[model samples]
Target: MHPMLNIAVRAARAAGNLIARNIGQQDTFEVATKNKDDLVTSIDKQCEKVIVDTLLKSFRDHGIIAEEGGVQGNPDSEYQWIIDPIDGTTNFVQGIPHCAVSIALRHNGKTEIGVVFDPMANEMFTAARGSGAFLNGRRIRVGSRDSLDGAIIGTAFPTRYRDRMHAYLELFSRLISNCADVRRMGAASLDLCYVACGRFDGYLEQGLKAWDFSAGDLILREAGGIVTDFMGEPNYVKSGNVVSGNPKVLRALLQVCDVQNLPAILK
Candidate 1:
């Protein structure tokens, strides 16, 4: 592992273990509504603190943009850690065993390393730019399905959006007609990781923050997958709206879903 990723892997595993222990242990676990569709728990905040404290302790000059906790340290630092301490909170709260700790390092505005650790399955997905992608230290790649006609795809609900529910439904229906299957698994980070590992041929989502995608996008790109926006541009890192898949299916799926006029915000 690269030195930066080595640190991320260590931090993610430590935080994931702490989170897994607290999962489903108490119905009285405190919860707060970030919004009607979004929820946050004490575990999320605590896990994020553990990760932030660990990373910042050694690299005090490094910047951090994270879920649960906001930005800290130097924003213009060459090394920035983007973190989702525990993604799949809905699954975690429900005791579904699909959540994980996701962390990444960005240097000069491009990803340098990424780590997503799923404690329940003991699976660790890691990637460093130009080094290829990995699961538990072994190589991994995107699926080889050539056609969307029989390929399984994934989607996520943008809990932050209120005006686009019906729009999403319409698009979902159109995709259902063309694709073999679609799944909405409620865990944005893990859903994208699954795409990176070839469990899903493609994944699309909107209204995501950097913490939700920074690690996943790096993993998917390193895993031989192509990721872009509906415009088919490499806008995944900038726009938050993302579409990813193996090359063949990525092209096919974009043809039906690309809304060039929707503006970058709606991408």
Candidate 2:
């Protein structure tokens, strides 16, 4: 593993341990609302601090873009660590074990290392730019299912982007009718990891922050999956809209979503 990737794995594990220690204490922790439905808890802040501090200790000059702490370190540096201390805060607060700690190191605008750790399951998914994706040290790959009718898809609720709900529902309805089934696991980072490991044939979502998908994006790509914006372009990280899966499933999803004709509200 690259030294930077090893650092990221260490940081992710540290933060995940912190989160696991706080499980079932949601009521004791002070919760703050970032928006109508979005939330942040003391655990989120503490985990972010742990992750950021851990990374800085090894690479003091690298920049950081974290969920709770925001940006820090040298802004002009070629390397940036993108982190989401708790990818599924709602799930965590609700006593669900679907959340994860996500960390990614981007060099010169491209992700070089990605790590997502789920403490509850003790599963660690990781990848480097050219290295293959892995789960618990075993190499993994996207699912072989190619047809939508046989594919199980993953997606998120448009809770944070109510304005685009109508467009999302339209796509959701079509997917339900066409695919074998659909799932909403509530964590974008884990959703992407699931795709990388073949847990879900394909996944899509919009209105995500950079930290939400940066780590998982690189993992999926290295696992032999395709990731792109709804327009089938490679700008999902910037557009905050992502669709990913094995090559054939991704192509099928883009055609069914008809992203090019999506409503203005979604765009």
Candidate 3:
């Protein structure tokens, strides 16, 4: 393992444990609404602080872009650490056990290290650029399912776009008719990691932040999954619109949902 990735794995695992220990008990800690659909607990803030503090102490010069703490560390540096202490806040608050703590380190604009740890399942998915992906020290890969008809797909709800919900519903309807099944897992990072491990064959979403998918997408790609914008363009890294699965299934998805001006999940 690369030295930095080892550090990220440890940091993410530590944060995951911190979050897991405080799950259902969070209702009494304190809750804040980032929006109607988005919720954050006092634990979330604490977890981010722990994650950021640990990383900065080790690599004090690397920049950090996080969900709760915003940006911290040296912004002028070439390296960046992206952190999402709790990816599925609602799930965690409701004791659903589907959220995760994700961390990604970018070097010169390319994500070089990624970690997504689900303490509930003890599944730690890690990846390094060009090195491939792993879960619990074992290699993992995207599903080889050739077509959407046999694919188990996943999606997420828009956080603040009720008016766009109908568009989301229509897309879900189309995918449901052709795919073997559709799941809305609430945690985008976990959903993408599941796709990498073949738990789900593919995943799409509408409206996501950089911290939400940056690490997960790189992990998926390193796991041999293909990632792209819904329109079939290679726009995922910056646009935030991401479609991921095996190459065959990804291209097939592009043919189906690659509509012009369609609402992109990551955008």
Could you estimate the TM-score for every candidate? 0.94, 0.97, 0.95
lDDT for model 3: 0.86
Q: Is candidate 1 or candidate 2 better by lDDT?
A: 2
For model 3, residues 126-198, the per-residue Cα lDDT tens digits are: 9999999999989999888999987888887665777777766777777888888889888889999999999
TM-score of 1: 0.94
User: How many pairs of residues in model 1 come into backbone collision?
Assistant: 0
lDDT at 106 for candidate 2?
88
Instruction: Give the C-alpha miss distance for residue 25 in model 3, angstroms.
Output: 1.6
Which candidate achieves the best lDDT against the true structure? 2
lDDT (C-alpha) at residue 84 in model 2:
93
Ranking by TM-score: 2, 3, 1
Predicted candidate 1 versus true structure: per-residue lDDT over 23-116, tens digit per residue: 8765747777787867788888888888988898889999999887788888889999999988888777878888889898999988889898
The best candidate by TM-score is 2
What is the C-alpha lDDT profile of model 2 across 1-267, one tens digit per residue? 788889888888899998898876866797889998888999999899989889999889989998888789988899999999999998888889889999998899988999999999999999999989999999999999978987889998788778888888888888898899999998998999999999999999988899999999999999999998888898777888899999999999998898666764256
Query: What is the Cα-based lDDT of residue 54 in candidate 1?
Result: 88
Candidate 2 whole-model C-alpha lDDT, 0 to 1? 0.90
